[model samples]
Target: MKAAITLESVTIRTELRPGDIGYVIYMHGDIYSKEYGYSLGFESYVAESFVEFYKQYDANLDRVWVCEHNEKIIGFLLLMHRGKAAQLRYFIMEKPYRGIGLGKKLMNLYMNELNSLGYESSYLLTVDELPAAASLYKRHGFRLTEEKPFSDFGKPLMEQKYELMLR
Candidate 1:
């Protein structure tokens, strides 16, 4: 189990321990399907990405933050090195955990981590369905870099890429 750090009654863990990966995958799969009508393909894609990240994991340049309440993970975000840039991934918060400033706190933690790692910029890929997250990204200085129709999940979804220059 990862050590938990409390922030205003919420616990945020920076380490990815055993069973954390499964929980992350399950949470994404279940939440996305219920919230956006996404199919299993999305979960499969997540699993693949997790596997790839595991294979090439770099402790010095990669991090995953898991947010918890009452010892249950309620949200998570990832920062992975991508050359000179950091890639933000799997940023999500359970519905019950929204609107309480946890999202903002998690984001701030992510940005601080990236800055400490010396990343020049950070980027993330997200769908248009997540207006709240998109708004948060925008508020954090991320600008839309690309948008395109993506059907990889068996539906016509608008995929967007956002980037934030740290320097």
Candidate 2:
């Protein structure tokens, strides 16, 4: 079993390393499958979006927070720049890392960056299964603008879109 990690043992880094994306992808597949019963399609979708994020990445306009414990990734989130807005993606943490302040720390950092970067607006897409995330987004001034029931992830779910206007 993995040893317990105290909050002080956690570290948040902004730079992406060589294997970070792959590890993030693997974590999503492994963690979600066990926790939420998410299927392989969800992981595939994450990979495709991560590929797009990497391809279009701009140091000036994009940001990511990689949370590590004992030099291993435990959580992460990304803020991707769109035409005149920001898109939040891949905000995730391992099961053991939840109920802690790390997610809020990432959100606070992401929100501050979004507000200061001069984006006209910001948005993200998520499934209704993620109530905790939605709650965090709402607390950070994001509002649910749209939702549609879909099976694209190989399961019945509501695809939700949340938006925040910075301008």
Candidate 3:
């Protein structure tokens, strides 16, 4: 993981079709394991075939973005578009590139895109233990919408939901 903030060698863009689903699934799985201590049970792709996952992701490709570094997929963010409101379902950065601002860049891009799409607000959920993540969301104009105890991977965790009104 490169900890530098340079994205010169990295390319970030929207996922347009099913062809990019495999990379999204693989990167997302690895990132989730590193950040959340468990995979999203995304066992199909990069293990078996990605027929089912591909279909699902493809159906909502407009809400997904892929970041590639050195021609390999590194990270991704998934957004659930709901008319005027958007929910950030997942955001992850793999272990090797933890300290870099890739997470922030992904988030800024997501918010900017959503705003341009006429969204009035966006929401994201994060665990309270991840102070860095929570701070990042706050720095980007997200406020604490709610906080609650939630179980992740069978472990007790305090989850926080944040909202950013785009106006």
Q: Best lDDT goes to which candidate?
A: 2
lDDT to native, each model: 0.88, 0.91, 0.67
Evaluate residue 118 in candidate 2 and report its C-alpha lDDT on the 0 to 100 scale. 83
Across 45-99, the per-residue lDDT of candidate 3 in tens digits comes to: 2334334333544333236667777766677676666556877855666665556
lDDT of 1 by residue, 1-167 (tens): 96544357688888998998889999989998898888899999889998988887899999989888888988999898888999999888888778888889989988888889999999999888889999999999999999999977757899999999888
> Going through the candidates in order, what is the number of backbone clashes in each?
0, 0, 2
Model 1 regions lying over 4 Å from their true place: 1-7
lDDT of 2 by residue, 1-167 (tens): 97776667799989999999999999999888888888999899899999999999999999999999878899999999999999999999987888878888889999889878889999999989989999999999999999999887778999999999887
Q: How does model 2 fare in lDDT?
A: 0.91
Between 1 and 3, whose TM-score is larger? 1
**Residue pairs with backbone overlap in model 3:** 1-96, 1-97
How far out, in Å, is residue 30 in model 3?
A: 3.6
- TM-score of each model, paired residue for residue: 0.93, 0.95, 0.73
- Per-residue error (Å), model 3, residue 96: 2.6
Q: Could you tell me the C-alpha RMSD of candidate 1 in Å?
A: 4.2
Residue 147, candidate 3: alpha-carbon lDDT: 92
